[model samples]
Target: MIEIFTVDAFATNPFKGNPACVCLSFMNDEHSDDFDQLFQKIAKEMNLSETAFITKSSTSTSTYFLQWFTPKNEVPLCGHATLSTAHILFDQHLSQSNELIFETKHVGQLKVRKLKENFLELDFPQGQPQPILLSETIVEELKQKLCIKSDIKGN
Candidate 1:
């Protein structure tokens, strides 16, 4: 039977952070049309924010095939789910190394390292956003939604 685990990413306690499902060897090949259907069904069963399917990839010795799916559909990249998968691998000793490289369909290989017990670090590609004109509409919305909250004991 395939081992499926649920992990709460970025939280010390369960149910605190975004929960994701990690399934090992969920499928054999990606070429099958039914593969995606079954994956979505499993994700729907888990009913989490996202579900990750891990498979042994032949791209490299350190690379593992990884795919992410939401209950509704598959997503390109999901940080929390990836983190959850890494946590599971390290926690259960499923992997031989503390560092892991994941091969994805879109964003290329991603890396993760175990920092300490119950802690891990993710390597992200550097992104530089192009300059854009400030929109008053967005500013007003942000001000209305997330303005500020501070009170130093009524000081």
Candidate 2:
């Protein structure tokens, strides 16, 4: 069975901050077509906002393959989940180095470094904003639902 950890990201105490479930795998397991489905099932079962799957890279000791999943679908990137994954690795003494690299499918490589006082730093790449046009009716509906009074601007 795979090892799982539930962590509170960006919190010094328990029951605070965002909670994320992290799944750790050590073996060089191949990702079959059913692997993502299995991960989705696990995420659904966990019932957390986000679940992270971390697999140790066979090529590099300090690098791992990371994937994030929500209860509904897979996500491209999640900051809290990434922090939780790094926390687990450091807490469990799974990594020998102070720096770790997480390879993702959509977001490329993310670097996490362990600092003094049990703090962890994540070097996340800046994402470019994509503009989307929205209909006035939909915007009005959203504004009404969100209780927005001022004008809502969209691309």
Candidate 3:
């Protein structure tokens, strides 16, 4: 049977932080397609933002393979779900190592370290946003909504 942990991470309150379904694999793993379907079904059942599945050796020597799924679809990387998975592992004493490595579709190598018993440190890359120039029509709409007039004219 697959071992699963439902964990709340990143916040003290149960409902405030993200809720994640963490599953650890053992012998005779589920098929890829079945597992994907399982994730989709469980995610839909939980109706959470994301759920994570992690698998590793008993010694934790092998890298942990992680997959994240949203209620609607699969996501490349989910920070909160990853943190929740790590938290569950750490709490269970399964992860004795100070640092936990996660390989994801988006984040190639994710490092999650334990700062304290309840605190975890996650290191990931930042997503940069591109600048968009607003058109005069959009600006006018904003002004009308906010009741503020701009002195600049349309180019």
Q: Pick the candidate with the highest lDDT.
A: 2
Per-residue lDDT tens digits of candidate 1, residues 1-102? 657998888888877988899997643444333567888889988888899987767665546778899889999899999988888777765456778888
lDDT of 3 by residue, 12-126 (tens): 8776676778766521242254567877777777677787876552334534767888888989898888888788767765457777877666667788898988889999767
Which regions in candidate 2 have their CA more than 4 angstroms from the true location?
Answer: 26-33, 132-155
Question: Deviation in angstroms for 109 in model 1?
Answer: 0.8
Clashing pairs in 3: none
Error of 3 at 46 (Å): 1.9
lDDT, candidate 2, 91-123, per-residue tens: 776555688888888989999999865688999
Q: What's the ranking of the predictions by lDDT, best on top?
A: 2, 1, 3
- For model 1, state the Cα shift of residue 147 in Å: 6.5
Q: Which residue pairs clash within candidate 2?
A: none
Evaluated at residue 129, the lDDT of candidate 2 is 95
Query: Higher-TM-score candidate among 2 and 3?
Result: 2
Model 2, position 13, has a per-residue lDDT of 91
Could you tell me the lDDT of residue 40 within candidate 2?
92
